[model samples]
Target chain A: MQKVFGRPKGLTEIPFHYCPGCTHGIIHRLIGEVLEELNIIEDTIGVAPVGCAGFSLDFFSCDFVGAAHGRAQAVATGIKRALPDRIVFTYQGDGDIAAIGTSHAIHVAARGEKITSIMVNNAIYGMTGGQMAPTTLTGQVTTTSPYGRDNGVAGFPLDLPKAIATFDGAVYVASVSVDSPKNILQAKKAIKKAFRVQQAGLGFALVSILSTCPTNWGMSPVDSLKWLQEKMIPVYQMGEIKVAEEVKGL
Target chain B: MSKVLLKGNEAIAEAAMRAGCKLFFGYPITPSTEIIEYLAKHLPEAGGTVLQAECEVAAINMCFGAAAAGARVMTASSSPGISLKQEGISYLAANELPVVIVNINRTGPGLGGLGPTQSDYFQSTRGGGHGDYRLIVLAPSKAQELYDLTMEAFDLADKYRNPVLILADGFLGQMMEPVLLKEKKEGNLPPKDWQTDGCKGRAKRKIASYFLVNELAEEACQRWQAKYDQIKEAEQRWESFYADDAEYLLVGYGTCGRIAKSVVLNARKQGMKLGLIRPITLWPFPVKAFTSHFDGIKGIVTVELNAGQMIEDVKLAVNCRVPVHLYKRQGGMLPHEREILKFVGQVFNLPVRGEA
Candidate 1:
């Protein structure tokens, strides 16, 4: 019981390289834990994205492959095709997934390529030093958006989870956050559901883990959590976007 | 075991499925569209997928998508369509995906005519797309070659986890010939040991192809190069006809290879010592076999449906002193054996092979 919330054996023992108070590590732990609980450590292959989360491959104990910027979905598609019996997924950050990888993700869903995508929405490019991201919220100030994400010039922030839900090909989708304990539990359940859909042969699945970027957001660990609760939650929301309940024996 | 008359294009699509292919994504193009049409009617029956994509670009990307899901996949197109697929082809190679593609070539730089052509010699054998990637390319001359080469392509692709291409010209795709099909095996390829099928009982898995660290991509590239050299050593394919102690030789592949064969046989009766060289593996080029004959021969004339494309290789193989001449036609099939026999007479200094 003590080890229930503990990390999965599939995750390596190495500490994360994430900046202080960043929820990327937390999201990683949750995903790893789910993999262990399911007992699929040996069969899992991870497609790492181009952001700081790109190295999520090294943190995971299982085999890994890295994808070009915004191309994790495409890479994941290939991997899944070649070995349809394995449980494949990708770990992508906001700038990597929603921006450059947007079209790929869209097409992946449209094709329903029987894989899972774990997208971490941190609102800024952490590795490149807080540049604007496609998911960067309005009024959010970053190194690139010094004027606080000017809607006039930078355009509107993308609603990723909702945007993806409209696709007919994706069988399961959700936008979960790391702000509260209740929300964290919900996020885990969402991640679990995404995997379950694939297990049930329900075609494409994706789970967007709404997270925080303390270093890039220019806030302390505590303040970052507070900001995530205050600003990001209402917008990103929490819940399963779609599910094939009938196929899953609901 | 079954043998049936099949066009090269149809043989390819059928052989792909018989080898455990589950998905085919392609757009229609001349010479190769028959492959798509066949897959559309057959794949669904095999519990596989077949989609006519919006464009060659979209078609190849769709192959990328199916590939990610851990499925055996392929796509077919001609020269122009292949040009559009180069980007996705690069991405597929970058990921080290096992994809099978069939390109029935037509003439080109711009919407080249639908007639047969081997102008894509460099593009198919040499790395056509960006990056340090080489697709294992097989050039098939007959419908039987198509059946056998496609099976080999899938096996090689899976063995190395890379893409394999079958380069046949319009002649192979549109022409009909007898093909003996192998026994259908249930589940021949290894299951996607790395695919994401959901982890209800065990753990999460991910499959992708990307290497960012310069040293890492380089290391992977080196690994791939080593694999290619090994394949080159083992699988370079060709056939020889009447070359044993011959005075002159004709060099070609696919349609040109067949055309050269007829002339070689006719040149035999005339007592002129002329042999033929047909390369089945375009990438490996069969350089040593084709060129070494020059040590004893007087001249080598390379014939093809393209203006002197393969002649370049012959010269490179035999060296400048060997007098590597070119016999070429453009956007059309090369004329029959008589046209070639006329040249054989001139090159070998023989009197018109007992009338044209």
Candidate 2:
């Protein structure tokens, strides 16, 4: 008998608390698989932010520190500075990274802290019952913006990866997706490269994953993936936003 | 150990490094920026690291992260900057992470002036941050005590797994005096068995302050309260001078404490029986130390740089046993020794030195 598929060794037996159709499960699996494949699971510290992503403290087998809302980058900066030999990563939601934590995000990249950050952009605040997010599209309707987001009043959706790519300190910046098997595989590759960038002692590395919030989006799990592909892929500008010459070789 | 003339802020930084603190995260602010600058130059050579964070908010969160990893971590800021750090401070308290926070307080109700003021007494002593939590607060009046208390702060923080604050004023931060710094601690201190280094051979551990279950959250709260109770019992620190056979007792802390001491000495020379009770540890309040001297004391005067914050605590300690008067200034004005003596003279109905 051949064993083909099983849970990654980096994940725990505890069941995920994410919504049934949430893409968080897929993204979590990709990260777990990457950790296992890198054989650095035991040497890594994961910082989990306050959101649906905050629950990652329980999901990862590696040591975890839970951060207050939007402060995961600052927390990760501390861990990496203290233990430079160990790998550090932060898992943050769009609201946690792009909204209240905007200053931390910009400065963390500016300071060139040698850590990895994964921004799960579901375009809406999932944990807080679908409030409008900084990444919400202009015409998107949310709990806070029931009449649809007005570009003039609410401002345009932030293109974070593109903005981050301009920072010289951020050596690697990639906007990935997990809408399908192919995109999931691509997301894993980007995540692994980001970790490798840290191992090489390069500057900051960020991988933004376009995730789906099925329950909050009022769509089926299957339809949520479709919405992400049809609606999000056009707006987010997928693929590598920036890669330094040193990082490109990796 | 040899004595060195160092400013209060530099002495604090040096003392922290000598006490085995290896990680310092801070943002630049007046009267306290020297601590960051000193550490940035010296900490890396000592095999530690100093990170200039994006802001005070980020600096404290950085401390939270490093402390969770079982490192001796710290952050220094002034009043306005400390206000920005309150959110992260509350989070650190909730997680029960041991870290040292230094508040070189300046005048503030908003972004007030950069001068010496004890305006942050209530903020520091009354759980400055949100939620129900207490930080071990130490008030040092001089550079020597600043060095000594900074060392003690690290041990106290680790001993109880709680945040310990060194509440100083801008004057204390800027003043220069001889200080005997401890030798750098060799090898490692006790193992932080609870640190989230890695779960290589053991079950995964999480350093988190959140508990969704109601009973679990209540248990966590009880745990923090129990620790605070133990600290309050074992860690009350104060100094009483001329308190024996004295009819009047003057109470103060930090810069005001030092000023009050001179007033007591001047009053005594003029044949007015006066004593001074200085609280070294502000959080524990030194209530027992102050109340014990109330037997024959006719009145107690609390001198402060704030309007009347510490007077409330003094009254509570005295429990109406004697009159508690407030001699105070605000907005960065230092209460002079002469002015304090005049106020004490008025409180006791004594003959004034200048009165004909």
Candidate 3:
């Protein structure tokens, strides 16, 4: 109770505009905490994709560049390449990253740019009003998939962290959820690892956090996090999928 | 200070290095790919940035990112690719960012042939992107000029706080010639204090075009137009040849200028009173010269690779002082020298040039 409850300095003093009990605030805090702890707030540059979190430029104290729709990976790659001495990362949502920007994310990793990515996997698109996200489970119901997503109709939900872990250019890959306090701690650790890996000059670190959207999911904050745990985690396991340090060869 | 037999592509690359261009974002397109490939191999070795972006849109956006960080960044593409990059170009212009772009034009309405052409003259010179904006466009004829123009391009871009286009043709990209690279010759044009280097100790700098209100955006556009007006006073450059006592003025830019140059020399040898007004900066369009030529010149013959883009501008500049004839050839190949001379002959109605 005495410690571990401090706020991140990387975030601005202004309150977030997200809805109450929305996990975006929690995830943003986790990333901000990592940036603050690493003392990278002043020099760290973030590429904010076009989504709900895309407005993060106004919230984060660090230098942030807003990318065009679904093009944050490419922007981050350019920013990191030009300012290789600084820490560069991107904050993207599932629709922004795994759906429209799948090619950019894959190619950015494949190119092995020394950058980190924080992909928020909320099974529905929040900013655009609860559309079926690329990570939407097969039987998930959203505004777009009102009858529950049929695999035959909408294709299978993409397992992003697992799919990205297979790429050889990725240095570290992990999936974490914000459903429980224990998982939040683990999520903090994963975000830290991504920043640390980028600091080490390793290539393309990604920490995919399973997030919640109360406003769009049409549920109370409690039910959304609970739904993510009961429904989303079975499709996306919350653990590290690939670790570069564990590989045998130098 | 390197003296190398460099092509236009290599010259721009070498000159960029001399100007401290450590970051390059480009997508591979014909004629312009050498600039991308050259940077790809060199930037990494020199502790710089080289990203072969996924598409022209992504590539220019990458340049936007790098330039936002105060990096001397550049991108190169052909006509069609430049079309794809138009939106980002407008954004960069709106944000008043310093970046260099090279368009090695091939014939194009769409995916036009890979052959060299000056068809993109209007695309590069005029505001191809949607905006009340202007880019300092340098049209280089020779490989050595490519080097000279590129070094100047960064300065012009920084001076205007805008993107500068090094508009070259495919022939210039491929043809080799001796180039003399310079170091810091522009005499410290300016430091990039306008860029966002995280604004460490200073007030945070915002690099964006987003405005919530239409009125605010319109005000920004007006401010941008003022910058353009100031740019015209400072950045207009052209090369005048045989302007003193010429009867006909042959006007062109990029590769067409070179062909027109040879034609000028040949016509001079034949004692035909012809002069070449080659616009080195295609954007400002040598309006002064275009207006001045009306006093004595019989006609202004405009040649281009495209159907008739720059000719319209030439006609506007002439303002009906003289007949502005459009001598255009589309497709990849250069207009036949004989065919052009025949048109020249018809202009004077003199013996029709070798039975044409």
Candidate 4:
């Protein structure tokens, strides 16, 4: 008997601590596999943001620095600057990257820091319950926006990858999804390409993956996938949003 | 061993370089801006890196990143800027990463003037950020002490795996004085066993402050607290002047300490039996130094550039064994030597004239 699939070498044996039906595990697996496929697991330094993504330090078998909320890009910049030869990446959640760390996102891109960032966007803050996040869909219901996200009051959902793609320093800006097997494979490809971009010392690279928080969204695992496809895919422009001609072949 | 005249800020920058600090990240703030400016021009020539961060918040966090990557890093700012850096400093302290932070103390409560003040004694001594942590605060009185203490600060930070702050005032930072700079001390650091450089063929490492599990978090907190306790015992430094047979003790630090020394000199010449105790390490508070002089002192007068913040620590050290007094000049104003001397004479009921 042959086992066609096994745990990626980038992931540790420890089980993830995410809530049931959460897609964080899927995104983590994709990233872990990407790290292994890129042959960067040994030379990588990961920065984990505060929130559910913060536990990435324990799940990845690489050097990790747990950063303060929204400071993942800043920390990643520091680590990458200090050790230019080492590959550095930051794993962050929507709340960690978009809500509180928006300035870091804009500035890190503007400066074109040579590091990789993976933002798991679930449209809600999962670690602190179903709170409204920067990517919370318009008219969507969450704990913070109980009456549904009113664009008039809460403002419209931020299409971050599209916004980031405008920055010249962001050589590779990808908005991916892990809602299906095909999308999962595409997510892995984007994640791998992001790391490869870092390996080549290209400017900043970011892969924002549309993930699902089933426990927070009051949906089953199957329905969460359906909701992400039906709702999120329409809002956030999917596929590679930005690719510098310098790394177009990569 | 030739002495060179340098501003206090530049002296700290040079001394840091001499101590093998190769990374400096900072934002410009008054009085402390020269440190970053000097590093920007010189660190590149010394095969180091200097980054002008967007803000103090980013600068301190960058220090955390550089320090975690096994670089001797530093950041400098003034009072308002230091306030902006508190969050990152808390993270550094909690993670037990070593870095140097220089606070050229300026007047504050709100964006105050760019004059010297000791108002941040509480902010530096008592943890400025949110957490159960302590920064090893070194208060330097002059350019020479600033250079010496900046060099010592790097070693102390690495030794304890904690942040060390050089707490200076605006006057000390802006003033220029002759200092005998030491030769570059290379190869003094031990290998950083816990740096997050890479995990290839080695056990994985984490630079983090979070412990989600209840018992593990409690245990980690206890371990960090134990480190603070050990630091307090091993690093309480102070200097005493003319205290062998003195009756009055003038307690001060930074610029105030230098001022108190002059008061001691003039009062002793007038047969006033006064002495000075200058706390070099502000965090450990040098309680033992205060206790040692409690036996013969009639009073402890704390002279500060703020509204009597360190006076509380002095009173705590005295424990009512002797009368404790405070002479303060608030909001960037400095206390004159004669004013401190007059306050000392009144505390001891001595003659107000120079004949005391």
Best by DockQ: 2
**lDDT tens digits by residue: candidate 1, B111-143:** 978788888888877767888878888888889
Alpha-carbon DockQ of candidate 3:
0.45
Question: Model 4, which residues run further than 4 Å from truth?
Answer: B184-190, B354-356
Q: By descending lDDT, how would the candidates be arranged? A: 2, 4, 3, 1
TM-score of chain B of each: 0.90, 0.96, 0.94, 0.97
Q: In candidate 3, residue B127 scores what lDDT?
A: 75
Model 4 alpha-carbon miss at residue A80, Å: 1.0
Please give the TM-score of chain B in predicted model 1. Answer: 0.90
Clash number for every model? 37, 0, 0, 0
A-chain TM-score in candidate 4? 0.98
| Cα lDDT of model 1 by residue, A1-250, tens digit | 4654555775788889788788887788888888888777777777787778877877887667666677667666655655677787888988887887687788778878788998888788899999999888898998889989999999988877777777888888888887789889998988887877777768888898878888888888889889888887776756787765553563
Task: In candidate 3, list every pair of residues with a backbone clash.
Answer: none
Indicate the residue-level lDDT of B280 in model 2: 97
> Which 10 consecutive positions of candidate 3 chain B have the poorest summed lDDT?
B347-356
lDDT of 4 by residue, A157-208 (tens): 9888888889989999999998889988999989999999989998999999
Q: Which stretches of candidate 2 lie over 4 Å from their true place?
A: B184-190
- DockQ of every candidate: 0.24, 0.82, 0.45, 0.81
Taking the tens digit of each residue's C-alpha lDDT, what string does model 2 give over B304-328? Answer: 8898998998888888788889998
Candidate 1 TM-score, true structure as reference:
0.81
